[model samples]
Target: MKVLVTGGAGYIGSHAVQRLLRDGHDVAVLDNLGRGHREAVEALRASSGKEIPLLEADLQDRAVIAARLRELGTEAIMNFAALAYVGESVTDPLRYYENNTAGVVSLLQAMQDAGVKRFVHSSTCATYGEPEVMPIREDTPQSPINPYGWSKLFVERVLADHAAAEPGFAYAALRYFNVAGSDPDAVIGEDHHPETHLIPVLLNTALGKRESATIFGLDYPTPDGTCIRDYIHVSDLIDAHVAVMNELDPDREDRRQMIFNLGTGKGLSVKQIIDAVKEVTGVDFPVEHGDRRPGDPPSLYADPRKIREQLGWSASITDATTMVRDAWKWFQENPSGYASQA
Candidate 1:
């Protein structure tokens, strides 16, 4: 299968590309280098022994995207492009709407024009928005509290509508939780500017990149009085994506649209994650308690039974210890992340 992976130079996208290549699929990366690193793609190409074609362009460039879709003869598109920071999205809603929502509209138009029907969308659990229920399911009502969540939900609606209108279109929206860990080989891993993820932030603090890791809200009603979240390994998350790609039927007259929640069906608190990092790296790091960020849910995890029974996909890397261990290995190898390669 020849696939075009948008934002393939980013952390999760690059890991997805690596999985695609390893599965014997031809992959091309389309990234604007806005939040993506070019070195990640190069490292993937080197590690996979494949010349991964890279089209440096934005998703909103309809003409360029359409041309690239036709030029590459892409059979499928795995879209990972978006502005994901919840705080940033709150500060600038227009940017989030334009890039995350409108950008998908442009990509959909390009796909429609080029007759590329299969799309694997990288959705998020943020769409669930402070659910009162535990272990969120696919049927959970999408009442997103933040602009970032709304942006993703908007695109998801677009995909659903497109699939309904076009009989040939097929799509899979994988709503993910906190995706952590790196490739076991330590070749590629999480790298973000002013990283916001809990595990990586704690690991960075462990590495002495920062003074201390802040624990937000120890007053939440949980096992440890802190908010808990589901953390999935990057490799396992990509595996589910590829599984959906292979399962998609672009020629189906019914126009199949699949939505799945990808997670380990477990939640770990912030303190637990910090403790795991300390255990993994054997580093006692300073910690500071802080107020809860507004709109933060007490607990967010996935049921995952739907995807497990339907797609026969389940997360294999379930332990927080393993996640922290793999991430710590990568951090030790590339203390400056992709910058070390540059």
Candidate 2:
């Protein structure tokens, strides 16, 4: 199958693209290069000896997307495109809504016009907001506290409607937890500018890229006085995407819409992750404490048993030591990230 990845050059998107290709599918990536890097694609090309086709276009422009999809003869679309920052979304709600919510609508519209059917939508656990319990489920009531979660929920609603109305339009919206780790090859990795994610930030601070990482709301109800979360390896998450997208069918009843949670179904506190990083890298990174931010919960993890039992998909790599170690390996190799300056 020939697939189109909407945010193919970004961190998770690029990693997903690599997995799709490994699954014996032809792939073409559509990235605006706004927050994605071209060199990530180039690194794959260098390793595989195949140049991935990439388009420099945004999802807001539907015309260009339609043209690109038609030109590539794409069979399915895996959407990993969105602006995801909780604090920034709080200040700029409209920006998150426009790009994360409305942009998905445009992408779906283009797919509808192109006669494309299968879809693997990249969603987040943010839609679950501060989960009511430690292990969040798929059917839980969505009570998103911030614009970022609301924007994702809006897209999930749209996908549900499309699955009902259109024939042969099958979609699987995988709600991801804290996605960490890097490609085992060490060629491609997380390189978000003005980095916000914890694993990368800790690695950066260890490398002296930043001064210190702040532990927000450390005095929570957890045993370690911090929050714990379910961190999933990016590669394992991508494998699930490939497995679902390949199984999509248009004429099957009660099979068009599938939602799954991607994680190890366990929680790890902030201190545990920091300790793992220090254990892996042999660095004592400085840390500080800050006030609790809005829309943050004490602890949230996933019960990924459904995906494991049904799709034969479980997170095989459950080592935080490796998660931190592999990510630090990539950071060391690409000190300046894909820019080749470090």
Candidate 3:
């Protein structure tokens, strides 16, 4: 299958592209390079030894997307193009809506015109803001407290609307849980300008990128009075994408809009993660407790039974200690994210 991966130059997007190619599908990457790095794309080509065509373009512009889709003869689109900063989303809601929500609108139109049959949308668990249930399921109602979460929820609804109006179009919205860790080979890993992911932040502190780690709000109603979250490896998350495409093809009659939550059913608390990092890195660093960041929940995890029963897939993630070690390997190898980008 020939597919176009929007935002394919970013961390998770690049990982997804690598997996798609490894699974025997042809992929073309389209990214604007706003938040992504170019070295990641070049590195992917060099490491894989395959010529993965890349276009530096944004989906917000219709002409560029349509031209590229038609030129590439893209059969499917896996969209990962969005500005994902929860705190910033709270302060500047328009940016989040424009990048995440509005960007999808133009991209959807381009796909509709291009006759693209499948779209695997990169959504978030943020859609289930302050989850009322222990293990969040697909049917959970979306009530996002912040604009970022609301923007993701809005795109999910937009995809559902598109599926309803156009039977020719089909999609799978994978609501990703706490995605962490890097590829075991360390060719590509998670990197951001101002990193916020818990694993990376902890590792950065180990590397002295920051003074020390801040455990946000230690008064939560959890085991250690800290927040707990489910962390899924990057490789495990995108594997489910391939399964979704395989399960739902053009001829299938179950044209119903399908939603899948990706994560391990188990979880790790903030304090537990810190301990794991210390154990793996062999470093005893000072831990600081700060005021609770607004728009944060006490505890959140996953119930991946739906994806497991339906897609026959479950997370094969390394232990938190092992995950921390693997991440330490990457950061130690290249303290700065990518060689060229640095």
Q: Where in model 3 is the C-alpha error above 4 Å?
A: 339-342
Model 1 CA deviation exceeding 4 Å by range = 253-255
Using TM-score as the yardstick, the better of models 2 and 3 is 2
Q: Rank the candidates by lDDT, best first.
A: 1, 2, 3
Count residue pairs with overlapping backbones in model 2. Answer: 2
Global Cα lDDT for candidate 3: 0.85
**So what's the TM-score on candidate 2?**
0.97
**What's the TM-score of each model vs. the native?**
0.98, 0.97, 0.96
lDDT of 3 at 333: 77
Candidate 2, 1-342: lDDT as tens digits: 999998999999999888877777788999889899998888887777767899888888888888888898999999998898888899999999999999999999999888888889989898887767768888877888889999999999999998878877899999999999999889799998889999999998999988998889888889998988899998888988988887777778656888999999888899999999989989988899999877578889998988888889999878789888879889998888888732
- The digit string of per-residue lDDT tens for model 3 on 173-266 reads 8998888888778888888988989989988888787889998898988889988888888878888887886676655657346689998888
Lowest summed-lDDT stretch of 10 residues in model 2?
Answer: 246-255
Give the CA lDDT, 0 to 100, for residue 118 in model 2. 86
Q: What is the C-alpha local distance difference test score of each model?
A: 0.91, 0.88, 0.85
- Candidate 1 residue-wise lDDT at 4: 95
Backbone clashes (count) for model 1? 0
Stretches of candidate 2 off by over 4 Å are none
